[model samples]
Target: MTSTAAPDRPATQPRAPRRRALAERLLDTPLADALAGPHTVDHYLEILRPDWAVKRVRGEILDVRHQNEDSVTLTLRPTVTWPGFQAGQHVELSVDVDGVRHRRCYSPSGSADHRTRTVELTIRVHPQGVVSRHLKAHARRGMFVGLSLPRGEEFVLPTPRPRRVVLISGGSGITPVLSMLRTLTDEGHRGEIVFLHYVRGPRELLHADDLAAIEAAHDNVTVLRVATREAGELPTGWLSGRFGPEHLRRALPEDADAAAFVCGPGALVESVREAFREGGLTTPLRYEHFAPPELPEMDPDQLGTVTFAASDQQVEGDGRPLLEQAEAAGLRPEHGCRMGICMSCKCRLQHGQVRDTLTGEIHGTPGAEIRICVAAAVGDVTVEL
Candidate 1:
């Protein structure tokens, strides 16, 4: 005999806003705590709704836009608990796929001056990207995902806006700098602004119409769109070929002091840095890398043993990242943005030393936190996992 029963309603179902507010208030009161003695209020609230939490920040997908075959834009409505983000900061977004939670860092593309709690994230789907592909294929309105508070400080607008500003980006790297541009225009900035964006072709350009509108509305702005792979005659305001020193000269006036912000691929960032160096410009060139910088080959003789102190697991270092070695040893550790950007895989170095893969710097401080994703074992090392 089989029992026939109705399944619980999906947590994605919308709840009355006032009711949720009352419940949240009640949960915060001393009476609810006394009634639920010694148990977490979140555990019970989670049974009522998936997105409800006492301290964790979560957002519901409010809209999804397919920008192209390989990219998507998701608009999210974060819970009231969310701390607002700066124009150029990033957040760690987490989603569950096949019973495993995966997290990635993404910069919001929307203006920070908007009078709303919604955030926009434009994601490029890499061929091997798990979260990006999952979002492109399955993300929809009402889906809930975990979110971290805004987390970057370097790639932001200066306190006193420069008289002249140059913003450069390539591929999907346009998101953050686009946010900066939107914020500047929204604030009615009177400074001269030059925006340069590079893509494979016009079809791959993100926010082309919006960018054109911005340029048209603001006399102080100049927008340059470059299609690196296009051939033949190009239209006005559009150029063909990859970024080079010529493009740099076109974007910036000789001897003109301008603040610069760049975000893109490693090679593109390097090229821009080199261009600045070659030009002998003293202007600050701030940049953010979309991927981890390439690491040099590690000497095999320097490899040693890596010990997970908490798990009591040891593996012979193979000149690979500690995160990879721990995973090979059948230990599951929390990690996000394996590129070392999110700091999700950070662990305390309990004993011994480890080498930073990106900078080749060695660290051996006891109780020092290190990002395991980009750290390789220097010798017999122990880390609190």
Candidate 2:
């Protein structure tokens, strides 16, 4: 005979009903009505406790560390309501710059340790990126910012983990891979790990000290770094040029069953994919890129029309992203991670065909959900926004 035991709830779970009753009673008071006449509960809460309580998923900047001239890492203490995250997932971060709110997605470059009540994000300031520039230059401790729950499943390790793994990353793509490495090291993973990373030069290296520590502490770990901008002094048989087929072939582990994870720019990711396909190294390969893969130039005849059913308006699809088109047409749709990662701009396609700008694949199924940040219309289409 088998006995099944019920699960135990947290100590705070039992207090929720009591809290709800208290809240109801408090709202019945005349002061509550006076507060509600012109403002919302969030406004009153902000007035009572400005820095801690927020209507959205919020976090306070606890510390900042500069990893390189172009990048900085921020340690954030998130609200208690934040559901925990996996190692390689990303979160949408929102900051207000010059009275305009801008949001972007960034993967935390550290372990998801809930006990510490903190997560870290490493961001590179792009040339023309306003929010990135603000974060790198003016962001300081005690500043509160909005955060989304962890997202993305494409570049993560599989369950029942592989005995041997190869991780490849280029430039800022090292962020998510760093999270995976931190998680593995913390959990005492004894499997063989070969990490190959590429950067412009030594100055641009991300998480250098951490990688060095990992290599020194674990006998099963190996680190190979390549520099693209280094001048005439090459180590014997080491890579010097930009990442290419030769470099990838040298970095691939000898084990045929090893899983491979790659992240980088679209060109780098595609190049690695092609190299893997040609080399017959078919152990499960996963790759992610911030930008869409390059597609052939859109012909003038390929342009289609997009209609918004709710607005009774239409616009010509110029082969750009649907989000850009919608914004140009004066529709302020909720969106985050404009790189097609967060899926915040997803909407139902009521009719006609749409092409994915990333893979150049056409999707036309009725009532299909489409990510507007990366999809473009192929013909006359209607989207329920």
Candidate 3:
């Protein structure tokens, strides 16, 4: 049989070997033994280009714009080490402030299915947030920051796609859900999407223009802008106040089988969850929290001494997280997020018991790892830090 190549098909080029192959080949040479190591090489490469590293994933800021008075959005071009992310995933971004490195978790506010090599992060600049304030005040195009691979799979869209989706977010929590909405729209999703976002006022809304455009362009998408503070200022069709059962009823049809996703403050998430439960809705309800869960009140007398096994230091616990106690005692253990979500402050429980501040459960398994950010000493405790 004879066949002719299609005119629309372009000629393909052979794929080149990846950086790992090149590194392996270089390391096999005798010159590899003469250098200090990969660390020295990485140091030299970083001197030439901030994003150039053997294994570390770094992103260079390509654009920075203030979304509003309290928020800034950054467009980043990550190094090839980045593996990309799902629509609803977040990354641990690390940046240097003064002389100390601070890390925080942030979700990308862009379409995951978009044909681009960049990601966008919309950060709300809290008055006490070190990283957020630094990025807002000092971040410039071409500056580099460290990035962890994408994390969190709980809030991603369902694989087969549901017939209807309900997205609820408040304030800065719109980031991940916005990513999901953008991805679904880019994929030409046919399902009905009801997006309800709550903000203090119009001035606090992020990506207001994009949301308006998306709602106008897509017939299947319904966008509701709710103003909690300036309720009287909202438009006729806009919503007023926070989320409640009535809002849920307004968003979802009585007989509709819809999957719900919520990302926002603890109160908003809890209210959504409670509404779902009260309404007897069986469809999936997934949520994400940016802050640490509220801990139950603890008695100061119940808190005991904490011993750092490796550091050979001890400190009297102050009814706070072990990580805070460690910091107060002049020990700098590696940590990220400081909210127990990143798992970067996990340490071994050498002895004694600790209480999970989030769940109020006590754990005493020897040698088991515990997240120091959310684990408090039940009594006298020993930890491998």
Candidate 4:
């Protein structure tokens, strides 16, 4: 006869505490980010945590797509703590290579879709770019990386979406502009848009498929391509005729309140700015630069000494960036982008003058925040970092 009473419950396992389980699942354990000191816990256990939860904002490479011959687009999945970014904004990505964290800034190339908990960054490998090279060569699906909150103000979607918009992009500078266009398409922006991309050849055209898709889907979208190499008539220095006042006038909507965003190499951005000015298009203009503009010739003899007060290190400064100097002295200082765009290497100038390596501007005011990645000490200096 079968026993009516419940048989011995088959070795049921005890359930973990709700709060503890949640904390572990989210990688929100306290003191997890601290690198040293006895107060830190679970520092060694980080390998077991989900990539997105291990730091302030961690992300894992969900997918990678080769957009063209020289560029690759990476899809990243970040944790919930990542402050949602606006289209045309950039974030700092830190990848650990051989136990060293190398950081760089990249604009998201995907739509600002927070609901999907995903973003994309398209990167082109620079000759001396360590992070870009590694990401292109080795970073693959499921690789965990560190990230900073989105930071950038010069290129964001303007409120009330202007009646007309023109997007000018050069080479790989299309990354952020692509994001803005995708977002506008998703939001059903009713404004007329003129997008002009300048590339050396059709193979060099980044996001050609996406641009074609946007043009096919939206009636108000007009996509134009200016292949500089193909247009041999243009001067060797700048692609002036391809995107000048005449071109703008012909391409942009007439007599409509318009806003223009220019992104790309320094020459392209500057050329577009001049075109806008010459055309007398008194509309809002925004720009983002992938590289520093041509700086005035710096004096080779003008060098300084940099004293790291906290690290108790002193090093002779060269015309190179302070970040590079500090590294040469065997002191590891936090930095990103090395281009001064991300503002990740910002530090206080305790006492001395520093020169902006990009714009050739001087900052003698002590106690001001300076980006060490692009600022060189002008004379004897002391830094708080």
- Among these predicted structures, which one has the highest TM-score? 3
Candidate 4 lDDT tens digits, 22-85: 7655545444444435633334444556552433677888998887655778999886567789
Clashes of 3: 0
Question: By the TM-score metric, which is better: model 3 or model 4?
Answer: 3
lDDT of 1 by residue, 80-140 (tens): 7787878889999999899988898999998877574688999999998899999999999
lDDT, residue 282, model 4: 80
Off by over 4 Å in 1: 1-26, 29-54, 229-236, 254-257
Q: Look at candidate 1 and give me any clashing residue pairs.
A: none
lDDT for model 1 = 0.85
Q: Write down the lDDT of every candidate, Cα atoms only.
A: 0.85, 0.80, 0.85, 0.79
All-Cα superposition RMSD per candidate:
9.1, 7.4, 4.5, 5.9
C-alpha TM-scores of all predictions: 0.84, 0.82, 0.87, 0.81
lDDT of 3 by residue, 154-182 (tens): 77988888889888999888999999999
Residue-level lDDT tens digits of model 2 in 1-385: 8654434546558698898667756755668757787875545654565453333467789999888778989998887547868877899999889898888899888886444468889998889777789999988998888888788877787776788877888899998888887777777778877788887777678888888899899998888888887786755433556767677666664746578888887877888888888877768888888667888767777777899998898999888888889999999888887778898899999988888888888887779999999888887889997
Candidate 1 positional error at 261, Å: 1.3
Best candidate, lDDT:
1
Q: C-alpha displacement of 92 in model 1, angstroms?
A: 1.5
- TM-score of the candidate numbered 2? 0.82
